[model samples]
Target chain A: MSAARVGVVTFPGTLDDQDAARAVRLVGAQAVPLWHADRDLKGVDAVFLPGGFSYGDYLRCGAISRFAPLMEEIVPAAKAGLPVIGTCNGFQILCEAHLLPGALTRNASLHYVCRDQRLRVEQTATAWTNTFAAGQEIVLPVKHGEGRYVADADTLAALEAGDHVVVRYLGGNPNGSLNDIAGIRNEAGNVVGLMPHPEHAVEELVGAPSTDGLGFFTSILKNLVNA
Target chain B: MARVIVDVMLKPEILDPQGQAIARALPRLGFSGVSSVRQGKRFEIELEGAADEAALAEVRKMAETLLANTVIEDYSVRVEG
Candidate 1:
């Protein structure tokens, strides 16, 4: 059987593309490097928008990056049910693209936060989180200056009711995200976005306390293979 | 040429940590009884012709779509003669 291919997009000033691709490779998948200017997605099964300060974080964190030519393809592809996952700035981009609900604003403490954090998997039915059990606790690294997740009250209510809130901060509300939401998925269960860097914890050899993030990659591969 | 000014600010319900930090600093600087401070963006656009209703509407579209994220922000546009 052929390996599942995951496309990792690299926007200008993106810092985590290499690590994201490496994480995919570590989980026995082929990592395809995608560029912001390139329109083609290279026929990958899934796409990942990695974390970084894209476009120098101007105007807003993910605001400029979403206008890249590649999004012309990604946005429609995501709507058509192609599995997509975004971490950190990638999460910000997903929101700016309107593929996912809500906006990520600056941290409530008004400072950049970087730490090994704990997260509770709240919805295991989403493509990126199927390998995790509901209420499962996992550790991942989070590093972002602007990570507060916000949305309208109705949207927040819908997400909770629809089982679209995929992850929540387990121990501490790191960034004052409303309802302690660390991640969420779209209505179709294909698109997922989170502020914590799961790719950073995919390999225990990289000084990650546990390889808990490997479940995210494995879960998607399983989903694609079954399809 | 006409100049249009656009002011973008976070909606009243959303929290503004940066603005709160600024408001806190004023008292330490010996300023007193200041209610609050909210920081926002101001964009001054120069157009090729004198401002008209059509031009103002177009600028409003830009503010709605790109210049401001309406999900969390509110924007106002005015012409500067």
Candidate 2:
């Protein structure tokens, strides 16, 4: 069988698409480049929305990118079970697009936080997290000015009840996200969004602290093969 | 041409740290007696024609779709000469 192919989307202001694609290639998967303006998804099995100041973070983080031509295709595909994972600014786009519930707001401290953050893996059933052990802790780099995750009471309750919280910040909440939510998955478990840059932590030689983030890429490849 | 103004503010339940920072600095600057402060955004859109109900409605849609994220904000639209 051929190697799995994953699409890495690049918007006008995207900065991490290259790193994301490198991570995909490191995992032995074909990394297909997807453009924000293009309507085609390139027949990739999964899509990765890398972190960066997309659209210069104009209007709001991820607000303008939500209407990108590629997003119009991705939104419906995600709803139909096309696996998708977004990190940082990409996570903001997911929220803005309503692919996932809730919204990411300014940090409670009103500062741009950039550091290695410890996160607890809360769910392993999702396509992107199946390689991780439940309750396992890992470190990933987080750098963003507006990474606070917020939701209404009922929505938070529902996410909790459905076991949709994929990961939670451990030790300390860097951005004051509600419930220390670092990552979340849809009910179907095919779509996931998180604030930390896993793509930046796939290798230790590049000073990533740890190679713990390679699991996310590997998990998707394995899942696509099985499917 | 007429102007359509849209004001977008965070929801009351959500925390506004930027506003809090300003509110905290106000007292130190000798400005007192203010209870609180909440920051928001205002956009003044110049319309090509009269600011009739139809034009106002279009601006409202723009506010809803772009100017404000209703998940954590509320917006008000009005017209001015």
Candidate 3:
């Protein structure tokens, strides 16, 4: 079987692009490096926006990066059903692009938090969480300052009504995200934005108790194979 | 030339940790009578012509689509001719 080509986009000041690529490769998929300035997607099956301080987070976290030329294509393509995963700052860009609803805000503590967080998979039917059973618990590293998730009441009700929330914080809510929402999927389930960095937890060599994040890379492969 | 200023702030219901931090620090400096403080963003736009209704209308659209996330923030545009 041919390996799935997963594109990991790297905007300037991106901190986790290479780690994301390594995660993809570790899952037996081909990692395609993508740049922010390029308008093309390089013919990859799926896209991954890694975490970082793109554009030096000048205006806001991801406020400037969302305007990158690549988003011109990535946004519409994602809307057209191309699967995409956005982690941390990438999640901010997703919301800033309006591909996903809600905005990530400053943590309740006004501090940059870094630690392994426990999350419960809410909807296992999505493009990313399909590898895990519904309600499965997993651990992934979350690192961010503006990690609080917020949306208007109507949007929040709609997201809840539609069951589009893909993951919720378990054990303890790290950044006071509204409803303890740690991750969410677009209505169509092709786009997912989460606060945790799943790519950083894909290897057992790191000596972590769980390689819980490996599911994300392999979960999307199913779509590649069936397509 | 005209100057357009837009002020963006979080909705009153939402928590403002950064603003809260500032408020706490103010008391330590012997400041009092401050009930609350909320932080926000300000964008100054320069228009080649007068800051007329047309420029104000356009800035409103920009504020909605980009300058502010209306889901969690409220913004107002003011024109200074």
Candidate 4:
């Protein structure tokens, strides 16, 4: 059987599309390049929105990017069960698109935080996290000026009750995200968004802090194959 | 032509670190009378004609849809004459 094709979207000001594609290829999947202006998914099996200051963080981070032509297609496809993973700025975009709940705001410390962050995998049932065991601690790089995750009390409660909190910050809360939330998944488990850069952690030889991020890429491949 | 103003502010419950930083700096700068500071955005939208009720309503729609994120913010619109 042919390998799964994961489309990595590139928006103006996006800096990590190449890294995301590399991770997909490393996991033995075909990495497809997608542009913000494209109106279709190019028939890829999965979609990834990589981290970066898209549109130079205009209006608000991820706010302008959410209205991109490609996102018009991605939103429906994600709703139809197409697996989608968004990291860092991508996570912010997902929230702006309403594909995910909450918003990523300025870090509580009022500083840009760049570090190898520890995350506890809280839900392994999502398409992008199935390779990880629940409660597993993984380390990945997180670099962002605005990465604090926030939601209303009701939304937060719903997320926790539904097991949608995919990952929680371990060690130190890098951005003062509520409940130490590092990531979350949609109700259908097809969409996942996280503040950490998993794609940057897949290559230990390249001085990546850990190879734990490879699990996300591998998990999507397995989900496609199983489908 | 008429100009409409839209002001956006974070919901009271959400923390505003940027505003807090400014507030902290004020005391050091000898502006001790201020109790707090909240930073927000203001947009001036120009229209081809005199501002009317309909124009104000339209600006409100824009504020709701794009000028601000309703999840964590609130916005108000008024005609600037």
CAPRI class of candidate 3: medium
Judged by lDDT, which candidate is best?
A: 2
List TM-score (chain A only) for every prediction: 0.98, 0.99, 0.98, 0.99
The reply for model 4, stretches above 4 Å from the true place, is none
Tell me the RMSD of model 3 versus the true structure: 1.4
For model 4, which pairs clash? Answer: none
Q: How would you encode candidate 1's per-residue C-alpha lDDT over B22-44 as one tens digit per residue? A: 99999999999999999899999
What TM-score applies to chain A of candidate 4? 0.99
lDDT tens per residue, model 3, A16-88: 9999999999988999999999999999999999998988988678888898999999998998999999999
Give the per-residue lDDT digits (tens) of candidate 4, residues A1-227.
Answer: 98899999999999999999999999899999999998989899999999999999998899999999999999999999999999999999999999999999999999999999988999999999999988999999999999999999999999999999999999999998998999999999999999999999999889999999999999999999999
TM-score of each: 0.98, 0.98, 0.96, 0.99
Q: Which stretches of candidate 3 lie over 4 Å from their true place?
A: none
Clashing pairs in 3: none
| C-alpha lDDT (0 to 100) for residue A194 of candidate 1 | 97
Which candidate comes out best when scored by DockQ? 2
Question: Candidate 2: which stretches are off by over 4 Å?
Answer: none
lDDT of 3 at A159: 89
